[model samples]
Target: MTTALDIQGLRKTYHNGFTALKGIDLQVEQGDFFALLGANGAGKSTTIGIVSSLVNKTAGKVNIFGYDLDTQREQAKAQIGLVPQEFNFNMFEPVVEIVVNQGGYYGIPRQEAFVRAETLLKQLGLWEKAREQARNLSGGMKRRLMIARSLIHQPRLLILDEPTAGVDIEIRRSMWEFLRKLNAEGTTIILTTHYLEEAESLCRNIGIIDKGELIENTGMKQLLNRLDTESYVFDLASPLEHLPATSSNLCHCTLLDPTTLEVAFHKEHYSLNQVFSFLNQQSITVQSMRNKTNRLEQLFLELVEGNKA
Candidate 1:
């Protein structure tokens, strides 16, 4: 019930007269895995920067875990750990030293910081390379090291900005699992990534920004439910010369090939069973089926496009 992060009437404008955030308002509940989504130059980074105190906000009220950022700057900052999109650590520093030194910036004792650094390195699968210079580690290893450094202070709220960018799928999945575990252990996380599937799988709530405006903010399920229609691809068990007719007039079917069919239907009017039954009646046997597009990605595109209109 407690709020982890809150922003009210937030605004940011550059000296060049470009507005990056236009009176934005958002909140993330304690213990929630929340996603902040937007296309490039959509103010996602600016919002994160302000929250992390890396960039100055033109005007706004920001509260982190009940501490107002203006009056309790240290307290608010102490509760947040940010893993930015770009790597910011010293390239020449040893992997373990980078993480250990981060804790010192928060006034953590050097001995305690070293212990926490080792633990995090091991947990993030970078312990074996603890002595290696950050510049020598692979891209995925660098990413893991950044995450480890972020966790050195053991902050209650973690903000990740495209944490998996440029990493391979295997490494990305590993990072996701680690983050999921962290969230389950009560560290509220706010994630911003181009990968909508990652958001759909990891976040319970979402806020989408477009052109300096917060266009959508709600439970993920509620947002997905707002989608009126969905398309599904069904692989037929046998080849078909032409398309088959279905009873539901609300559903549209197209044949992409002899063994493939694409069905588009209003979610409110048609069920999977209805589609299956219709295909069965027409002697079409399905081999497999899948969504035509990632549900979250489809909805995100629509929301951004609709906001433009």
Candidate 2:
């Protein structure tokens, strides 16, 4: 597969002698929806800043779609559209003009800029408020505006940092759908988000960064396959007085509430069907059941904490 982004032996150090990245090597294939996940202050922003040319790297090379950042700076940047973590636009400007002016930064003609701006605004569901000042838009609308501004130049690679932060569930899911359609249409996407479920749902590949190091880079399915334990939350039809006993000794059950039971078990030994059978034997009719969406969250914690150890 063709590489969309590549970083070789990337290293970064601030003037005060703070090392932000330590010889990191990573890659994302063309048209991939990749996730870069890390806890706060874990070099994620530093890595992104360097790739987007917002921050200078101390040592190492970065290539975007095979365009070397050093020798082909304009070519490399032209291929990427970055929606950074902060809202860097002018709050007083009309929403539509903000997007059109962004295209102007890339030297796009004024006439074509308006066309692209309209297309992006409509696609992002912000066309209705195009004439409104950016500060007048809701939090979710502001987030969508940033995305529209980023895409004004129609870049093939989109880098989003906390794209859905402060967005309500309905708006967040709508943004996810738009992103899915964009990725399906052949645009490569790199996402950095605190929402684990968002990563698990949208990204095909994931890389975990901790303390300025790339610890794990693999397919999302492969990373989740490393889990030996799986957990589920079961809501009971009636109030529960005690935790139910599982036939398998490896299974651990906890009472989350009077009517909620959480079960964690070695997935290899105790199949989900077996768990259901055991519950049936105990006459515990479950009102509803959901597998914990935080499986990746648990693995992420273990990996970061284990790296410290």
Candidate 3:
């Protein structure tokens, strides 16, 4: 597969000697829905900032479609669109003009810009308010507008920085559907969000970063499988008078609720069959038995906690 975005030994450090990003290497394939996950103050924002040319990196290389970012800034930027975490447009400007103006800055002709702007406004469900001042729009509307503005040049790679951060559920769902459709249409998407469930559901690949370092980079399915290897959740028949003590052989078992037992074990040593056998021998009937899927949230916690340790 062709690479849409490639980073090699990427590093960033502030003047005061604060390291924001370590030597990180990553590749985003063409038309991929890639998710970047990390805790606050991790290099997530810095990574996006460098790719979007908003932040200067202390060192490293970033290439977009074979074009080096620093050497071919214009061409590289032209092939990418960034929807920042904050709305940066002039609030006094009309919504349609704000989008059209962005196209103009990209050297797209006025007529073409107008056509694209109109289409985007309508497609994003903002056409009715196209003539309204952006300041009059709600927060969700502002986010939709920013997305429309970023696509004025129709870039192949779209980087969304916490795109659904402050939006309501309905609006976030709408944005997700829109993004999914765009990905299906061959646009590569790189998203950084706190919503791990969203990333697990939408992204094919994921990268976890911590304290400016890349901790894990792998296929989403594989990462989740690592978490599921020997984990199980048992919906018990009822709350027990005394909790079942886990032996050293049993690994870790946590009581998530009165009726749920979440357990994790190493597959090489333990199996779900063993769990069932033990429960059966104890004559404890289970309401349900299911694998406990590993999530980005859990992976993130592990990363941060490990770093602290």
Best-fitting candidate, measured by lDDT? 1
Off by over 4 Å in 3: 228-294
lDDT of each: 0.95, 0.94, 0.89
Per-structure clash totals for the candidates: 0, 0, 0
Model 3 Cα lDDT, one tens digit per residue, 1-309:
899999999999988899999999999999999999888899999999999999999999999988999899999999999999888999999999999999999999999999999999998999999999999999999999999999999999999999999899999998999999999999999999999878987899999889999888899888776653466789999785555776665477778887888777776677778877767776667998876764667766776788778
Which candidate, 2 or 3, would have the higher TM-score against the true structure?
2
Clashing pairs in 1: none
Residues 1-309 of candidate 1 have per-residue lDDT tens digits of 899999999999999999999999999999999999999999999999999999999999999999999999999999999999999999999998899899999999999999999899999999999999999999999989989999999999999999999999999999999999999999999999999999999999999999899999999999999888989999989999978876667899999999999999998999889888888889999999999999999999999989989
Query: lDDT score, residue 168, model 1?
Result: 98
Single out the weakest 10-residue window by summed lDDT for candidate 3.
Answer: 241-250
**lDDT, candidate 2, 1-309, per-residue tens:** 889999999999999999989999999999999999999988999999999999999999999999999999999999999999998899999999999999999999989999999998998889999999999999999999999999999899999999998999999999999999999999999999999999999999999999999999999999998999999999999998877866667998999998999989897888889888888888899999998758788889989999999
In terms of lDDT, the poorest run of 10 residues in model 2 is 240-249
TM-score of 1: 0.98
User: CA RMSD for every model?
Assistant: 0.9, 1.3, 3.3
